[model samples]
Every structure is written in structure tokens, then in C-alpha cells.
Target: MNDETSGKASIRRELLASRALLTSRDVEDAAAALAASALELPELAGARTVAAYVSVGREPGTRALLDTLRARGVRVLLPVLLPDNDLDWAAYAGPEHLAPAGRGLREPDGPRLGPAAVLDADAVLLPGLAVDGRGMRLGRGGGSYDRVLARLAAAGRHPALVVLLYGNEVVARVPEEPHDHPVDAVVTPAGTRRFG
Candidate 1:
């Protein structure tokens, strides 16, 4: 692997370890706080359509935020992981509609929309291990969001890109590769930070 890739792997290892240490209560509280903080962001308020995801395992929970947005009449979309690690989307009806998918992830059971559906979103909530001060994001190495971002760019769409994480995940730096796209904002339990 390249030096930047190696560096990111090392950092991800440490971050994952620390995140795994958080208790279930910690994750639950952070989920509520994250929803409150993110709901206040203008991007979400103004968005008519949002592409989001389900928070499984120890990742910063998105359930509260997802439900809140849906309650407010925003059309929320969730990712359906394709076999190749690219994402196809489906409308999120409610938590009841989610079924356990592969890799311990939860996905909407609604009709599948083509992967290109993300291009129609006004905003996208991404999952990541960390994002640097400059907004460069370190994803989980799945390359799913990478493909999403690339598709958005290819289609000339510039939806507000956001990542929800713990405060410490908003770090000083993360190795940036050519395919890495900078997020427009980062929302943590603490607050939200925006970038160019």
C-alpha cells in the first residue's frame, strides 16, 4: 500500500479501538445529542431530500437524526450496500422497515433505487473514521462513499456532504488521497464544523 493509505490504516485502527470502548449508554446519549446538533444545521433544514444511513455497531448513531428528519417531512434515503461495495439507495419508511443486511448493517426494505439516486439529494450524511481540519475524510476503507462522491462529481451535483462523529474524530489531519473528497461539514455531539 501507499504511504498515505498505510497512515490512514494506522489512524483508523486507533480510532476504532477507542470508539469500541464507549459503553452502550455513551453511544445512545451521543446519538440524541448528535441529532439535536445536526438538526440545527441549515443544510438539513433547507434540504428537501437527504441521503443518509443507519448507524450500526458502535458508530455514531444516526437513528435519532434519521427519525427526526422523517418526522419533519424530509424525504430520507438510506444506503443499500451492493456486492461490490458501491451503494444503492432506498427510501426509509421507518425503523420498522429496516431489515438486517449483510455485515451487520440495517437497510430499508423498500423498493431499490438505482445508485444514481444520490445525485438527486440536497444533502448526504456520510460515515467515516475521521475527517481532517481541511475536511478531508478518512472513510472505513469500504470505498462505498468514495464511489458515491465520485458519482456526484461526475454528475455535477454538489449536495452538502456531512459526517457525524464523536468530537475527537474531528482531528487535526488525515491523509488525503486523490479520490478523497472533502466534506462540507462535520457534526459531532459537541457541535458542527463547516469547511469549504
Candidate 2:
């Protein structure tokens, strides 16, 4: 790995280790707060459709926000992980519609809408370990969302890219690569930060 790649790996490990220390209660409280904070963003409030994902493990929870969006008559799209690590989307009906998947993920059990479906979203809630001051996000290095971002760009669709994270996950900087795209905003338990 190059310096940028190794640096990202180190930072990811440290952030994940901190997340592992969170108690179940801590995760729950953060989830509620995250939803509240994220809901207040203009990007979400005005969005007709949102592309999102279900949180697994200690990652900052998105369930509450996803449900609220669906409740608001907003069409919520959840991801289905393809074997190649690219994501396919499906409409999120409710909690009952999510089924267990590999890597401890919970994916929507509805019909696959194919990967390009994300282009129809007005906003996308991304899962990440951390985001930097520059709005660059540090994902799990899976490259799935990277593909999603690329697809959106290729189609000239510029949805509001947002990341839901804990307050501490917003850092001064993160290792960035050429293919890495900056997010429009990040919602933490504390509040939301927007970038240009």
C-alpha cells in the first residue's frame, strides 16, 4: 500500500477501536440523536427520495432516520450488496423488510432496483468511519460507495452526499485519494456540518 492508503488504514483502525468501546446504550442514544440532527438538514427535509443504508455493529445508527424519512412520505432506498462489492438499491418498506446478509449487514428484501437506481435520489446517507474538515470521507475501504458516487457522476446526478457519524468521528483530516469525493454534509449526534 502507498502512504495515503496505509494512513487511511491506520486511522480507520483507531476510529473503529474507539467505536468498539461504545456500550449498547451509548449506541442507542447516539442513534436517536443522529436521527434528530440529520432530520433537520434542509437537504433531507426537502428531499423526495433518499438513498441510505442500514447500520450494523457499532457504526453510527441510521435506522431511526431511515424510518422517519419513510414515515414522512419520502421514498427511501436501501442498498443491496452485490457479490462484486457494488451496491444495488431497493425501496425500504419497513424494518420487517430487511433481511440478514453476509458481513453482518441487513439489506432490504424488496426487489433489486439495480445500481444505477441511486441516480434518482435527492440525497444519500453514507456510512463511514470518519469525515475530515475538508468533507472527504473515510469509508470501510470497500469501494462500494465509491462506485455509487462514480455512477452518479457519470450520469450528471449530484445528490446531496451526507455521512452520519458520531461527534468524535469528525476529525481535522483524513487520508484522501484521487477517486475520493467530498461529501456535502455530515450529521453527528451533536449536530450537522456542511461543506461547500
Q: Please count the clashing residue pairs in each candidate, in the order shown.
A: 0, 0
Candidate 2: clashing pairs of residues: none
TM-score of each: 0.99, 0.99
The sequence of per-residue lDDT tens digits that candidate 1 reaches over residues 1-196 is: 9999999999999999999899999999999999999999999999999999999989999998999999999999999999999999999999999999999999999999999999989999999989989999999998999999999999999999999999999899999899999999999999999998
**lDDT (10s digit) by residue, model 2, range 16-133:** 9999999999999999999999999999999999999999999999999989999999999999999999999999999999999999999999899999899999999999999999
Error of 2 at 58 (Å): 0.6
- Pairs in steric clash, model 1: none
The true-structure Cα RMSD of candidate 2 reads 0.6
Candidate 1 regions off by >4 Å? Answer: none
List the global CA lDDT of all models: 0.95, 0.95
